[model samples]
Target: MPNPSSAVSRRTLVTAIGATAAAIATAPAAHAAAPSTTAAPSTPAPAAPGTQAARTVTVPATRARSAAGRAAAGVRTDFPIQYVGVSWDGPRRGGAIRLHHEETGPGSWQPIATGCAGGPDVAGTAAKAAPVSAALVPAGGAVGYDLRLPDGATNLRSTALDTTTGPARTTTLSPTTPVTFCGVEYLSRAAWGADESKRFKNGVENSPAKYYPLQTLTVHHTDTPNADPDPAATVRAIYEYHAITNDWGDIGYHFLIDEAGRIYEGRWSGDDGIPGHDANGNAVTAFHTAGFNSGNLGVALLGTLVNQEPTAKARRSLALVLALAARTHGLDPQAHVTFVNPVNGVTKPVDLISGHRDWLATDCPGGIMYGTLPALRAEVAAL
Candidate 1:
């Protein structure tokens, strides 16, 4: 459906009965820098000419019993890596284990940031065990991972994920064609291994995905680990947790931006969805806000921003995404706009690019990240 926001003459965008939206809303106008400017190795490859679709390979698990009886396992993947997550049977405790990775052979092992196995609190999935945070490894490189445990850490496991080289050359928009928005390239669901997203338990689903007219863009942070070795893996784990554990059926954000400035498609969108608009035209509706989700698009950074700021790459990518949203939706990035939650009949005034806190009384997109929204808006406006 054409987003009511985009279809200005159509009836005001409404969700449920008694919902009211403004009429004659005027269209308005609308990052960080990153180091090395290289795309994530697992940055979903765009479909190319004469190339087969990107394929997925699940590296076999390697497990060992330490001399002290602590469990340790490591696996290496040959293809470009996208997402990574771990499974362990245990309770939350003080002792910590480190998951390290080498971008290439014979290099120093760097620790990949991790989180609980159950997913992060920001997403509202309850934790079941202490699992390592997954990584979205940047740029296609020969990557290897090693899980190191102290004497007592046990019940540990890790998996290596490699997504498609890129999106399929053919989409509903074109056959053997390339697609891009703003100044950034987008990875398709297949590029990020959405097929690997954890399935809903018992095949049960929550309410069907909702749709709304594109209006506003909501910025968020996954609140997972920031120093991810393979952020794609962390994203996959989030997809799984949101689907299986939280029963949300899919990851909550419409797009995910890693520290490396890689943009991964979030919350699968169908063929009919709008390419540049928000949730309503985008096919996939998400749960990033409580009362106001339908018309808003969510672009989430990969890590916590409550204290620390996003990587330069992340900031740059966010600006591009918001620029696309603003231009496509006729929104002015620097202007404050009023939005009506079609679902709840509630209204809120927020910047075209808003922090999660603006919608709810929660510390979302983090205080540090939220504070940067003004600067981010300026970047979008410039774009």
Candidate 2:
């Protein structure tokens, strides 16, 4: 077992995985290291360093992108950053928020291909005094960032995450590669640096884990940067944003696949070794879709797929997981099925394997990835 608290690097999680379908409840604890501590900054710093613990920094909320799409106003951090997400004190809006990042050194700026729009403005979560951010944009190994917020997008702020800190994950990381539990390259929460303690506050769970009978398997793209350098840290940053900032108590998806095709376990499904289901195989309700959470299994690819195609490794893990879920849940991936909110009893027709945009008014999972949903469905069905 790798330490639960030690950091996980993209290198450790990268492995060649062509998996077979198996129920998560019966899966193995494929990898882990004992918990290790790193003093992460809770606030922003003024200059760049060789490395730093993973953390988020607030940046100027509004700026205009140049006609050439150059990053307008920006901020510098003391650590190498991996991803950036935009948030505002207002409702989510339309308009491209182009971004640029300085890789390690000043003047080496590059544009992030996927200009972000954040996530769907969900019900109930809209009234929080907290800023509502859309999707994330890639900023690989960047030490500085710049952005363009949509016009009239008030109180704009950027959530820039420096996930490329920490030492290179060594052999201490269990398996040091993907582990096959039946058929997928699964990374347990322990495989990443998830602070299980974050799931609780004042010794009580923020929201008790809830499960319902499985219905549909929905695929999503996190709208983060691609070619990630430290996916495990990225996962941790997302966990922080979702569990702490978003008050969701956990990351929203059931699973997360890195570009290397490793399927990171998401949403703290249970103690029975299952990633997203109860013993009876009921799906755990997560925060991905607003009105249709219950019974829908949400799996997010860990990057902005709309701008670039997911690597072949990511695509394989995605198909394997979807195939595994469909097999475990008795779903027909290629057919149109009725999706009923197990909590609200509201029903809608959906493909057996659908995209985030299919159920919400957002460009999630990206255009490039979304277009492959049909092919993904067939692949899942074939599996």
Candidate 3:
């Protein structure tokens, strides 16, 4: 496992001082009492010179249904789905809900994901229904799940989705080809079924476009269901959540990646479907990291990965995007970078490519994936 302490120390430098140069300059006292050995590693092995084959893959759409019962709720489908997720509208009684799936036998199902209901948000934020999801390594032919419910619960309606189509690339990823040259689907808001009126109730003109020089690239996990059947719907749901629930006026990330490695353009850039560029000719900024939103590009992988690993296609696509970003921004993928957020003017010294956890006090990008950063950077460098 990757060490969180190292990440904590690195983040402490920026978080302790706030977003001002004056705060940073006057915060020597914050570091004076710290141990001298609390720093990230100085050097890492360089990636070997090599070329990977180019490939193409597609994730099939998912279908879903729901029902109420004490026994398993089996929803059959036409094909096998590699992932599954459940959104329940059960009785609002908070309790531990156990979720599981099986290949061929009854009661032989394996536990995949867990979620709790009725718990108060530490900040006492507004209450909302909790959704849970799980990834299936060996895609199942049918979709059927059972929920171990607590006593006196009723009206258990669930939105269960199964994706029969697993990710399979039609072309291999060649080290020489940048992802920009690859077939990236730059879907407009309508393509993903986003209601512009819902997102901008005050009127489109009220929420003007915001831009900043794109600097560091930060990766994050949606922290939602990775087993979504329809990636587009998942994207739309997130848009609503971010715009309405979080009141951010837009999806926070600049780009979204599905489990099959498909990339979607996020956060309206006002350049039609083309990516917006800054006056200096760099890519425009996105609202991904809070204090680091300015001058940064956020690319979020669409799944929670606290204990599970991302799919191979997802990782490859991530490398391709990161490489393209490095090439576009004149960055060395393996080099250390210093970024000053245009929003708060706070600075962070980080890897040319970094995880969201590196910038904030949160479990983002997850542990399994975060540990792969060094290798990911090396792969980008090679590309």
Candidate 4:
């Protein structure tokens, strides 16, 4: 005779086991069975081959459900979904990497690997074929890596990651001008500031000042040559002349460059670097320019070039100075500004580079050198 209680218990056990087996077979590999706390019948049942059975017979159903939710949300795997690699395929070396994304959340990407050659270790080892790993990037973001050259300098290279599929962008950098050739320390505004107050000539001084967000750079040429012939003496003489003859607090121009292409500082204002003084009994502005004195930077060369042609060294120095001035002022080199000839009333689309004659009544920068202004600007643009 079959016991009635035993028969009921057997039926319940069979139903539960069938349901669990079906779930295990159909669910994804990421999902695994969770333990349950409810008591089972006296005779425990066996599951299919390769299936893991619940070890502890006391897990809450709520906990199992929470774990399943996390697994479906991709929380079970710690490995990154994307990877990055760097390589130098000849002409396609340094550039920035742009990452595009389909979603709009806070996302970022990082380098998991790098392909670089010999140099000092940075972020890690700096040898050829050495792999470097970076911290994980947030979703929808990018990172940049500067590859080291054999000479132990860095070049631009970038990588980006996107959780969603999107196109990548790259920006190549042009060769940089050597800091020494540019006449001032590269990227050091403070260094340039401290060097301005020294005298270049008996009466002239080079006083450095901050730029005041002005858009125009007024160019000029010093008409006299001191017997000293030394660049520092030339700058000193100009400062003294301006202070004594012109009765100004400092030099008129913001910068002065000697024929050797060395930059000297002139004038001082707060960090804006443009020359300005008090008004009232200070009623008159500094004599840097006549009409545009309020919003222009005056830069004077050390010697007269009206009759002589500017040398290659002088031209390069001027271009660098102009480029630096334009960048500091946030002026666009490519954007053309209108220059209406004060005498003829004819207007020309002048490049951001301008002459002293444009603002004041002087043959500043002279006829011979001024003719080459267009070419000079083109050279700087290439840089």
Q: Tens-digit lDDT track for model 2 on 52-114?
A: 333332211111111112322465665555556545444455434333445334444343332
RMSD in order of candidates: 10.2, 11.7, 15.8, 36.2
TM for candidate 2 is 0.68
Clash tally, candidates in order: 32, 23, 15, 39
User: Judged by lDDT against the true structure, how good is candidate 2?
Assistant: 0.60
- Model 2 stretches with alpha carbons more than 4 Å out: 1-81, 89-133, 138-160, 166-180
Q: Tell me the tens digit of each residue's lDDT in model 1 across 87-118.
A: 44443233332333353354444454333122
Best by lDDT: 2
| Candidate 4 residue lDDT tens string, 43-93 | 324646876332212111110001111121121112222212222223222
Per lDDT, what order, best first?
2, 1, 3, 4
Ranking by TM-score: 2, 1, 3, 4
Poorly placed runs, candidate 1 (over 4 Å): 1-183, 196-207, 272-283
Judge candidate 4 against the unseen true structure and give its global Cα lDDT, from 0 to 1.
0.37
Q: Candidate 3 local accuracy as lDDT?
A: 0.51
Indicate whether candidate 2 or candidate 3 has the larger lDDT. Answer: 2
